[model samples]
Structures are given as C-alpha cells and as structure tokens.
Target: MAEEEKSIFFPDDSHKLWSFGDTRTYQRLSSNSSGFLRQLFIVNIVFWAAFLIYFVLTASQPFAVQPLLLAVLLLPSIFLSLYVLVALRSAERKRLKLRASGFIIYAPLSQDVFNEHCIDFDQVRSLRLALHKRHFLPEEECLIIERRDGRSLVIPFEEVLTDIRRSDFMARLSAYRPGLLDLSEAPALPGEGGPSFTELWLHDFATQGTRESLGLLPAGGSLKEGSYTVDGIIGGGGQGNAYLAEGPNGTVVLKEYVLPVYRGTRLFEDLSARFFAEAKLLSALDHRAIVKLLDHFVEDSRGYLVLEFVEGPSLKELVEKEGAQPLSTVISVGKDLSAALLYLHGRFPAVVHRDLSPDNVILREDGSACIVDFNVARELERDSRTAVVGKQAYMPPEQFRGKPCPQSDLYALGATLYFLAVGQDPPPLTNLSPFEDAAEARSKDPGFAEFDEIVRGLTRLNLEKRIRSADLVYEKLSRLALKRRES
Candidate 1:
C-alpha cells in the first residue's frame, strides 16, 4: 500500500488518511478468532440435531412432520448461525496496527468502535513471551502485555505470519524508543537482525522437550493436565512433596500441598484460599536473593506452586560436606542473607520469614546465596495467634512463642553463620555465645573474635539486647568484610 493511503488511526478508517496526516501501519488478525468460529459451528450443529430429534419423537405420526413448525424452528437457527459466522469472520479479518506513538487494537465485531482499543506505549509496563500450555496438544506461544494498572492482555502467536510480524514490530518499537519494554522473561532473537519465524520456532521447540527418565509420575506424565512434567522428586514431607519439573519456559520446582480435608468442609475452603493468596504475594516479589514464584494452581483438591529452580546446594549440605568455612566465607554468606532479610522486612507490609535457617539458604555456583522455602513466611500482621513454626536449633524465644518479628530472622541468620563457622547445628533454644565454641579457631585466627562477637549480639536471649534489624546486621557485616579485605 502507498504511504499516502496508510492510516494513522484505525486501518478500516482509510478515508481519514486523506484529511489528516498519514503514517505507517501494520496489521494482523487475532489468532483466537478461529477457535471461536469453530466452537460456534459445533454448537449450531448440536442444537439443530437436538431440535430435530425432539420434534420427531413428540410428533403424532413419526414420518409426517409439519412444515410450518419445522420452518419456524429451522429458519431462525439457520439465520442466527449465519449471522454469528459472519460476525466471527469479520473479527478474524480485523486489524491490529503498530505505529510510532503506540499500537491500536481493533474492536470486536459485536462491540462499538469507540470502545477502549487504542493503547499508548506509556501505558504498557512489561511484555512477556511465554507458552500457553494445553492438554494433549502442542503448547502455543503468546505475548502477555501487562498494563500499569495491573490489567493484562494475552495474545497468542498466529504461526508464521504473526511471528514474522512480531519480530519486525519489536525491532521498530525498539528503534522508536530504546529500553521502553521490559523483556527479561522473553527469549532473545537469533541474530543482530533478528531470526526468521522458522528459526525462532525451532529454538522454542528445542527447549520444550519430553523428559526421558522416570519421575514420581512416569517420564512423560504430567501434573495439572500436562502443564508441568515431573522429572523427579526433590523433597517431601508427611503432608506434601516437591518435584523437579519441566515447565514451558524452563526447569521449575513444583511444590505440592495435599489438603486432605473434604472439599465441602469449611476447613478445606480456608486452606485453599490461604494457599493461593500467599502464592499471589510471593509472585509479586522480584529479587535475585529470593526464589521466584512462577505460577500456581489447584487440581484434584491439592494445591501446587511452580517456583524457579535455583541450581545449587543448600547451606546445610554445603557445610556438612565441606566442613567449617573460613571467616571470610562466613561474612560473605551472612551479608547475602542479611540483604535478603532486609528486602523481606522492607516491603510496605513487612514479611517475616518465620522459618529461616541454613537448610533453606542455597549457595549457587556463582558464589551468591539466595533464600528459599517460604512455606512458613507471612506478612507481618502482629497476630498473637500466629502459628509457632521453625527449626528448633534456629528459632528465637519470641518465635518459639508464636510471635516472630523481623528481628527473628536476624537471630536465625546468626545461628546460620555459627553453623558455617562451627560446621554443626547450634544448641536448640539457647542464646549462642559462639566465642567459646570457636575459641580454638579464634586462637588460630584473631578475626574469629570479631565474628564471634557479632554472632553473640545477634543471638542475645533478650529482645532488647538482640541485634534489632537486618539493616544493622548488614552494616556490621559490611564493615567486617572490608576489614578482612584490607588486611
């Protein structure tokens, strides 16, 4: 089409180009439009079959059908079905145009043209490319547009045509405004000029593979109707289990909660509600020091959470295998855990990790640490009736009484550092004075004196005497780290 004919507004409103300024336009149909047409056709056929059968069965003479009654029933059905097909066809051909300022979504055929279809670039918050999983069928790739107001639009890719157009659109969008979109969860294009539609599809196909080994559910069997393929079991408790699974994007840890209560009972409903609500809050957190909650759902009366798989060993396992780490390593790991706690406590509604211990902290190959297992974490609401939960060796006095605050995490952090230094779990439910425990090591290295002092303050029996917050702990650790490096 000529540049003069291209529309700055709706592509269907072509005449406006002549009166107003003209700009470039791109168009594509919504991929889901065909699915709607197919469903409508099926419903039309089923209704006709049912109506004919009922009329024949009720008739006085089986062979003699009244033409007037038949016409009354059949004509409207035929006309309405035709009208619906036409409307769906129109929607299938409707255009979505991308321009310099923003993009335009054509209104559905049944909706008014003035409906909210035009969206500016500024309104867009993120663009995530993810696969939409389907049962016993190929997963469909889609673009999820998250708006600033928490609304989102999911548009599935339309095979080759849509993929090609998307690559071009993304390129032009970047040229128009560099770094305007957050594509952290999106895959990279093949080359500097971007990949062809075929190349991109092929790359996606390679990553989404069928598991070759047996798991909790056989090699190919899945949970949540094939959304997640269980590869192996990672951990399990009496009430639940965790599986290493393959998700659409990549590897994930699928945590299961077996809610054994009867579905109709009030207890079952409350448990399900609380499980999903916490999942939502966990998903909102975006930080490297914490595990990310990717997706969540319930099936067969059991709740499941899809989490990012952090590839590393837990601090407990690392310490057990490697023995006591050096003072420098202890300080480094402490800082990472402290920063994670600071972030958790710093949220608008502060979060308390009721159970923080070496067992839940992972040490990655890159040498950074991240906190995991938020099953016992909760937003701080100062509820006196809060459940008492945590490892006995790491729990503070207040936490043991079911009153955990942000400072409780600090106490646990101190115990974790002691484990890293002493290579064994600290004595349960006691104020740790690690100086005596590490006295022999302190005699070898004077720095252990300072490290032990920090741990002592953090594990003080009285709340008033204990290290108050993650912020203060981080500052002290930072100075200790600097002093070690200078020496």
Candidate 2:
C-alpha cells in the first residue's frame, strides 16, 4: 500500500458519510488497502479446509495424524484467524468525533467502559505539537493539550488521521482559541541554549531564562569587561527589571532599564542618561544602610547598574507575613533609614530618593534596614522641570504640585512607619491629617505613643512644619532607641 494510504481519512464532496447530526467523525480505514485483509482471510480458510480434508481422508491409516496432533493443528489455525478478525473489527469501529462543544475519542479495543473519552475546550490552557522523527517515513505528529490546572492530554496522530485532516483540525482549533497553539518547543535554561519561545510565552518574561528574550539583557551572561554575570530577575516594575547577579567581589543586584514604549525616542535617551548619572551617584555613595552601586555599563542600548544585593525580604514582605512590628523594631528601622537619607541629602549634589516606601526598604537579617530602588531618585541641582513621581499616598503636599524637596522623602518614611504600626496603609493624603492619624495609631497600641510625635513631625502637611531634615529625624529616632535600651 502507498504511504499516504495509512494517513488520516478525509471525506471528499462525493463521500458524504462522515457527518452524523451536528457531529463529524474521522476514522482510519483498512478498507482502503485494496482487499488485503479479505484476501488473507480467504487464503487461510482454503488452506485450512484442504488440510482438514486430507487429514480426514487419511484418518484410518497408520501414518495419519493422532487425535492430539490434529487437535493442536486445528486450534492454532482457528486462534490465528480469530485474532486477525478481531483486529479487522477493531479498525472498523475506531473513530474520533468533533462537535461544536467538544471532541470525543472512541476506541473499542481499549479497556474504557464506554470505549470513548470526551474533552471540553474550556479545560484547555494551551495546545502544542510534538514531532517524532522516522527513519524511512514522514515525522509523526502528536497534539498535546495542557490544562489550566497542570494536567496534560497527549493525542497521537499516527495511523489515525490524514495530513490534510490534521492541518484542518489545527486551523479550526486556532480559530476557536487564538494564542493557544504554541508552536515553539520547550525552552532551554540559561547557559544551555538560552530560553526558547515557549518559555518566554509561559513565564512572565522576568525569570533567568527569559531576560534576553524580553530585551532586558541576559542573566548568567557576562557584562562590564566580564566583571558581572546576571543570575536571575529578583524584581521588576514599570521602568525595568532588577536581577541578582555575580561580580568579582560578590553577588550584586543588577538593575536594567529598558522601556519598550520609549525605544528610539528622545525620552529614552534622556532616561538612559539620567540612569547613568544615578549610577555614578550611587557608586560614590558608601553607607551601611544604603545599597551600594559597585559598577555600571551600557550594552545593546540598555543601561545597567550593579548594586549591592541585600539578602533579606523587603519591609513590605515582612509586614505582610508578620503583621504589625514591635514599636522598638520599627523605631530602629526608622533610625537606620533616616541615617541613610541624611547621607544622601548631605551629598554635594544632594540626591533625593523620590520613591521610598516599604517595598524599597530591605530589612536585613540583623534587623538593620537598607534603602533600595533608586531608579527615580534625582539630584537636587539637576533637571528642575522633572515630572512628578512617587507613591501618591506617601507623597507630601508639595510633591503633588511638582515640587519634591528632602521633606517629601520624610513624608514617605512617615507613611511607611504608619503602615508598620497600623498593619494597614494610611488613608490618602487628601483625606488624612498626619497628626490625627499618628495620634490614632498611638491610641491603638501604647507602644506607638513614643513614635507619635516623630510621625507628626515627619508627615506634617506643610513643608516648613515637616521634619526639617533627615538629620533631625535620625536624632529623634536614636534618642527613642536609646531610651528603649535603658528600660
């Protein structure tokens, strides 16, 4: 038989037997093989009949077969014929039916009770094809359906459907559920062939495998004269992704700035320049409570910053896992962060961390805090017409009017502290009176009373009335810390 004869059977215009009500059936038929099975059955029957006749004629002779020998010969031929017949019957009954709602597979030879398996489209998350290479024939294809809950169903196409019919089925499936047909193979990990298209699609494009594919430069790959190798994406935001990378000194956090929308635009160039400037400022900054920038480089039109990788959860994560912190712990964290901010303010250019919240502050294992995510931080002497940025709930009143001084960062710290004490985010600035909120927070826990005056000083609505500098805030928190220790 021709190779094409074994492929899936598709009905033509003249052959209208496939449809039954609203369902369409497809089958692989041995009937198309030019009477091969029928011929074999006839030949076997004739040979067996002749042998039985000869045996009967010679039954009385001494050379004739014994009863036991005759029984053995007859049983073997009968069993072989039955086996072939069963196979022919099974081939005739096997089929796949497709309906508007779902698909049904029928296999009479299998142990299934009803000899059928039905599947609904809604259970499918993705559909992919696997190819099996053959030495002397076309590659065999199998369809894999991955469900949303992680179960997978494999449907083999071998001797089941024709090439044309399989193509039609795939086309229909794609039309019914676009983006479900995944043509790409399973992706390799980093340092293997890098990530494949399937990995990029399945992952959120923030893992180690998909960095380069997402256009954020590759992790585990070298950068900056082979001094740093990105490991994986630690976190991500609207601006870019931050990666845990390895450097000559030790592990560092690599921040890559790649804005898809700003590519090829003047805004991209401006932001890139600002990113470099920030890197330089961070490299110069050396403080125990601040993430240190070790090195920086620009590659493939993307800016990269190598920063100190703090090995601890952010304050946000800690608060979420362990609810409200002890007042003493909160005071210590505040004191450490305030000192870090004072260092920034005391710089010659006076850097201001425009966006400082619980998420940006890492709580080290030793209970100390480190400030991170300086992507939006700006130098006081540069760019007066910068756009407003920072979390709205934490922004000072002047920040809403596009003027953020050192006091603005102090307000954010107050809001962050309030969250730590109250186990909830403070109400928006418009609806909130910082002093009243602080007093109410203190009322909840007597421990918060010592920090109420500090919170009020930091979060005062008027810029002039707010904490004058990070230095003063640090001094106040230090005194509170000292008092707690004495007790």
Candidate 3:
C-alpha cells in the first residue's frame, strides 16, 4: 500500500465524528457462542454416558474387567467440565456488577472507536455530559473522557470501535497502560476503562453473597419500575414530595407524587398544563444566576426533577435567622429576582410567577438571589387571564379585586422587605378586619415607630400606590442602607 494510494483511499471526510450518538452498532448479540456452550454441555453428557456404559459392561457376565483408556479420557473430560462451569459462574457475576454501575449503553447503532488520539488514563479527570440533561440523567450515561491539561475533552468512541468486539477498549487501554484493569483478562466494551471507583463498588455489591440483591433501573421510575434512591427531603409543594436523590450518576431532586393523589386533582386540567409548562419555562432560560434544570423524569409512577443543587439557604430563611437583612441585601436580591421576571414576562407565552414570596427566593453562597417555585405560576398565551396568582398578604389591592400585573411582583418585594425589617406582615393587610382599622391602629403599638414609614409604603391598600418596579425599589433600598450605615 503506497502512502499516496492510502491517502487517496482514505480522505479526511472518509469518516466523520459523531458525539450525540449515531446508531451504527446497535444489534442483537450473536448466538453462536451460546450454541457452542450448548454443544459443550452435550459433549459432557455423552462422556458421562460412556462412563456409565463402561461400568455396566464390566459388571455384566463375561465382560472385560478393566477399561483403562476410557477412564483416562473420561476423567479429563469430567474435570474440564467442572472448570468451565466455575469460570462461567464468575463471568456472570462480573456482568451483573458492570450493569449496576451506570447505564450500559449497548454499543450505539454505530459502535466504531474513533481513536485518532489514544487516551492516557492517568491524565483523565471526571467524564461528564456536554449538554445538561432535560428529561434524562446525563451524568449517568455520558462518555468517559480524559484530559491531559485542566481543560476537559470527550473522546468520540462510537465511530472507532465495535461494541460487540469486546476487546476493542481493552486493547486500546492496554496499548496505552499495560495491566490497567485488576484482572489479568482484558475488559469488554463497557468495562474497558480501568475499574472506576463506582464500578468497583458495583462489583462488590453485585457479587456479594447475600440473601437479597438489587439491579440498576431508570433514574426516573414508572409504576412498573421503581427509581433510584432518595437521600434528602429538600422542599415540597402542594403537588409532590421534593427530595434530593442520589442518582445513578449525580445529585438529583426527586419529585415523588403519590399516584392515586395525582389522578384525583380538582385542578387536573390546569395542573397538567402547569406541570409541563414549568419544564418548558425552565428549559428556555439560560441565564447564569437563574437555577438550571439538569434533568427530570416520572419514575416509580411519580415525577422527579434533577436540579443543580446550590449549597445555600433561601432569602426567607435568611430573614428568619437574622430578624431582618440590611436594605442593601434586599436591593441585591430584588435586582436578580426582577431580571428573571423580566425574562419570564417577555417569553413567548409569558410566564407569570403567581407566588413571589421570600421562601421561594434562594440566596446563593456568593450572595446572589434566585427565584424558584413556578408550581402555581400561570402562563398567559397572547394575554388573557381573569384569575390571579399570589399570596393575600403580598397581593396588591387590584389582585383582591381579581386583577394582577408585573407591578404586583414589585409590591410583593416591598412587603417582603418591610416584613424583614419590621418583623411583621404589613399592618393594613394583616388587619383587614374591623378592629384594627388601619395604620393609626398599628401606630399605637409599642415598637411600631421603627417600621412605621416602611410599613406605610408596602401596606398601600391601592395597587396604584404600591412600589411600582424593582428598579425603583433597588435605588431606595441602597439609599436606606447607606443612611443606616452613616447614622
């Protein structure tokens, strides 16, 4: 093969790369090896028959007493069968173990290894999904990649090797790092990478000689199949139980709703509309400060969401712990929350977060705010909704009359700040009853002076009089914080 001829035959595009996965290798496992094993079993049965026949002949009258050659051959065959049986039992255990660790991608339809650059195992960091998952757990099913430098990169494995070829990854691995795997024997396609920590644990757990055992299933579950385990109970809404789950791959928020409860909702039509709509709203927004949706699934006959778990507390909790946050803190939170709303309101169908309370606002470790909980939120497609969405205390006067707008959210932010500083809901809203008529009633109470002005601005019975925008609120809050510091 001349170099020129080889170059002409294999041009650059002679083969292209595919990462999202192309189906070139997916096929049923061949039955030839199984047929061979069956034949071997038949051979063993025949040898056992021969041994019995020789014994019977010797026992019969006038039969030859000794058949030494038959004994010599029969003994070896018996021993060989025993050895093979032991080897097979061990192989089954390993197969089951590998299946438990992660999704066993049964070699995509196109299972050719694209080995343009041979990987060095020692240089590999954790392999991860390029695109964060929307409906499926990406962390569990992603490609195992290696990086020589701090920069991460995934190798296009499918186009280079055949999945069923079994020794392809092992051969490639050993060529780079001899004796990479613990066993003297090389690994199959899925197990080609030197035994990972997860793989090792799976092996130990899977092969353990015990009374009961478990196997891998989907991250999300259906009534027929249960899902992965839940590790933490994070938050719960009226719809379902929200939990932090130990995903087969990574950290996920498991939203488990009782089956019978879901089928019996009065808001069935509206709930279904909002349920999928929430997922859609989350998928559309890609801003950094906003919470990201990693994946979601309906499992164990219930629904769950895999969210990027931010390690911090919510603004409500912050206010609770500190009694009241400085005005500066409120402004910073308001800015982020408002920006998110602006994005939501401008979206195609227009997302309206009906519940805009502090409890739903999470404060990141870096002191940034993120608004969450769109469970009760409604969408107005082309603008038309007679109904309203918001807590009574935070709702503007127009809302009580069954009308709300973007200004309603700003009013809520004001009420939240007043509550944080004054340690009470607005006096007017709280005292909508006959006895406590208005601010005059609240002003008479001890410790009322400190919050009188703040409460007045928030408790404006008229929506027209409430804080109109987050921009205005941000500026006022910054000024208050500055004044407080100087005094």
* Candidate number achieving the greatest TM-score relative to the actual structure: 1
TM-score, prediction 3: 0.44
| CA shift of 220, model 3, Å | 14
lDDT of 1 by residue, 111-145 (tens): 22212245666778876677755334466665666
Candidates ranked by TM-score: 1, 2, 3
Better of 1 and 2 by TM-score: 1
- Please provide the root mean square deviation of candidate 3 (C-alpha atoms, Å): 26.1
Model 3 over residues 19-74: C-alpha lDDT tens digits?
22211111223212343346467769987787678777776653564568567777
Q: If scored against the real structure, what TM-score would every candidate get?
A: 0.55, 0.52, 0.44
Report the lDDT of model 2 for residue 228. 80
- C-alpha RMSD of candidate 1: 22.7
**Model 3: CA > 4 A from native:** 1-228, 248-250, 257-268, 381-383, 386-388, 428-460, 474-487
lDDT of 2 by residue, 1-487 (tens): 0111111222221122244432333333323443434645775788678887887787787365677876778768766776765565454434555433345555432221113445566666777767744334455565666777787755555433522244335433432344567777633234555433223221221111213444555656777678888888777877777888888989888887763332223354355445645765676789999888776655444557778889898988998999877787788889888888899888876888988998889999999999987777977843244568888878887788777777888898888887787666776573233335545555655545567778877888987778889999988888887776776
> Which regions of candidate 1 deviate over 4 angstroms?
1-216, 266-270
TM-score quality measure for candidate 2: 0.52
The 10 consecutive residues of candidate 3 with the worst lDDT sum are 93-102
Q: List clashing residue pairs in candidate 1.
A: none
